[model samples]
Target: MGANAAAFASLLRGATNLSQCRWILEQLINSRYAGDIFLGNLALQMFGKLHGIGDARALFHRMAQTGRNLFSWSIMISALCRDGHHREALGCYHAMNLEGGIEADMVILSTVIGVCSALQNLCEGRKLHDRVAGCGLESDTVVHNALVSMYVKCGCLDDARAVFDATPTREKDAVSWNVMMAAYSSRGKFQQALEIFNDCLLHSVQGPDAVSFVTAISACCGLKDVKQARALEELSCSHGFLETSVAVQNSLINLYGKCASLSEARLVFDRIASKTALSVRAAVMEVMLRREEKFCHRFVIAFMLPSILMWCLGLVF
Candidate 1:
């Protein structure tokens, strides 16, 4: 690639506007590098970001008419997956495998695993897991993470935990811990989630990120353990998680309300810098309804008029 082609490719990569992307794509097509596979893949990526799925599919088919490389197949498959066309993405993945020349790599496997996770297709997920092992890519942390996540989504917690246990400690990141906690929490296994979360805190390899705290706190909410929830609130606040993450604050509010600690819930609500996205208002109403039943009506009239309006407008419960 020349300076001009390189610059154009960079432009495509950075482009956020669909119109500009189309114009730049047209320029590339009329230029000397029109037949370049890299440039074609770049166009496909730009189209994918634009959510122009039809255009992206057309581009992929056009590219395949001449030939399709591994990157080309991966891009198309990933684009389809991003566009919420999992069936097509799976079809493309299988088709790529049948194409005979190109072999699926870790990147492709990761993307396909995500598709399986989204679709919750355990059978296909197992096949892909086997393929990852057979290709000797099972040691890859990212691919292993994807495989674990897929099994978790498929409701195979045992399989997910097996993979989690087998993965080297160095290979396990915050995502690995979060996935296991989420799997347990989703299945109403809050005790297991909290245990994994404690282990996460103890090991501190990748350290606990916002999702880690939020997931564990959510598990605490499910269990309604006021003491543990309060401790998590302290940990989250001490870590500056509350300052940076609205989701953490929201989770804290919900946790407090669930634990019948209405004062702490109100404190969290008040501490939130921006309350636009939180469900704290509902948490307030819930606390009032459950714990302050005698004053619930008066509280709604005095302090929850916005919530009343939201209810009238069908925007809230």
Candidate 2:
């Protein structure tokens, strides 16, 4: 019976007939079945992935009535989270409290933190933070990272930094570092954010992946450092996805203009190659032209790049 459960779990992953799979589950229900706990939990998970919350919820309720274990609880919480029913998911957590004897681990804590962020329930989220500390999981790096992101999402920058600083100075993972950097970047503390980027590299957590570069380039734009920003753009080129993000391209143009390197700025601008690219280009030129206006006698705005015509006509935005 356990082997049959395992086979069902695996076959369910393939393009099997849904009606056939439903019939098997029905058979398991009727015949004094000895289904594997792992397989039942797998069904709960697979339903979430294949259908939606409606499907996962039905399977979850079935698992609960059969007196399944904590894995069932985690699966249900995760399914609710992925389906964006964050408030309801948090409600499930509270209702299940003192009932399942389930100890929330890093996976559950991280998912719950995301749910809080999605629901924008900062107060309940903070209460969960206290619960994490009470459980002595505060020092766990994954939990700490989740807390920092939760604070960031809630617009509590000060609290985010407080939790980040409280992290033990031991080696931090890239996830931890990235979340802190993202928080600071969001608040326009780009210099401090870039420092975190450096620390990310130094700690060997990771070397500038595309997302990391995008975040770091954001900081560079705030600092108006074209040279360093261009270097990041070049590094991202090595990742084989020649498709640069619009954010990256826009930031590069701004940095170059701020640094007064109009030639480099024009080069980056031309590569954008899109109609909507005009606004970011306009914004960059607007910022630069506004600055260069002080020297209006010395510089002219027209005839820099081919797209200067488009920049002139206000089509980019």
lDDT of 1 by residue, 44-122 (tens): 9889878988888888888877456998988888889988999999999989878798888899999999999999999
| Candidate 1 accuracy as lDDT | 0.84
Q: Write the per-residue lDDT of candidate 2 for residues 259-279, one digit (tens) a residue.
A: 667666656655665524443
lDDT of each candidate versus the true structure: 0.84, 0.69
Candidate 2 least-lDDT 10 residues: 294-303
Best by TM-score: 1
Error of 2 at 284 (Å): 11
- For lDDT, the strongest prediction is 1
Q: Worst lDDT window (10 residues) for model 1? A: 294-303
